[model samples]
Target: MAHWNFSLLFGSAVLWAMLIPCRAFPTGAPASACENMLPVHTGVQPQPTRAPYEFLLSSPSFLNGQPINIQILGPAYKGLLLEARSFGSNAALGIWKTPPNNTKFLQCSGNPHGAVTHSNTNLKTRQTTYTWLPPNSGCPPVVMFIATVAQSREIYWTNVKSKVIWKNPKATCGAQMLTRTWPAAALLSSMLLILLVYL
Candidate 1:
């Protein structure tokens, strides 16, 4: 009877150990390294200058956050910084063009001549547009746009879920992959521990 009770207790401990890794190492990909690093505003959320623009992609859908060419149609100026932030949390995602100065979370990874590449006007309609290519990895499910004026440090942010594009196929794969291996590893460890305890 004592031996049986010991085995049950040991097995329970091993099972608990197995669960720790699943929680510690999250299978889901984080939106960014600097996710939710920015200061939160307690006051009312600010309104955007105009309706959020559309994000046009070459492909109908993205795979595992793969790098894709994109174009934007909206109000953009020469000095304003076009940044992508995770929806709701507003964590810095990526910039269309590197800013003259880096934000708390965003690095200057944008093209120096980004304004020229991003901003163009239609000669016929006088509408301004921009183009950007987000990084190939670490993309969240959804993101919103922010137009930041460098000189005045003013920010114009789109409404939450304003522009939804790009989902990571790896988000599903990572979890499944971890589940496949984790059980095997945990079983092996548990068996070894049980054997040692019996001996």
Candidate 2:
């Protein structure tokens, strides 16, 4: 009976010794497992939260040589800085002649919609407008803009995306290309699914 007890105790000690390393190494959590299997998440940081100060624009797309207005019509954002930028073919509207002061216009052509106050509370409603005069004709029929917000105290830059809808309204610019949605939708859905799985 004494020999049998010693053998059982030795076995228990070995089992615990093996488990101790797993618990102490901290390498088996789901996150660690994912990190081991996948590349590091590398991309731009997320835009700050707009909360009540949402972007309002005239159209969802833009056309060459056409004038479009961008309105920041919403509540004030506390502890936040707003920035507007144009990318793709229509990028010229904002970054063309002269880029706005980085400190002031948020890189837009003219004035920024707002300088929201950051707070634990909700954002205030505010409004501003930016008119984009499209470049010469034959530019991409559709472009995009990124309106970003920076958290005052932190290094977080939150952004809201706007589709610079291009249209000749009068159809004088030539045959226009219709915007497609399937590709964007598919990409977004896939990302959401991955996020859900991780969560």
The candidate scoring highest on lDDT is 2
Write down the TM-score for model 2.
0.37
**N/CA/C clash count, model 2:** 27
TM-score, candidate 1, is 0.37
What is each predicted model's overall lDDT from 0 to 1?
0.39, 0.41
Give the Å error, residue 195, model 1.
7.2
Model 2, residue 156: C-alpha shift (Å): 4.8
Candidate 1 local accuracy as lDDT? 0.39
lDDT of 1 at 72: 46
Stretches of candidate 1 above 4 Å error?
A: 1-55, 59-61, 74-79, 95-138, 148-162, 170-189, 192-199
In angstroms, what RMSD does candidate 2 have relative to the true structure?
21.5
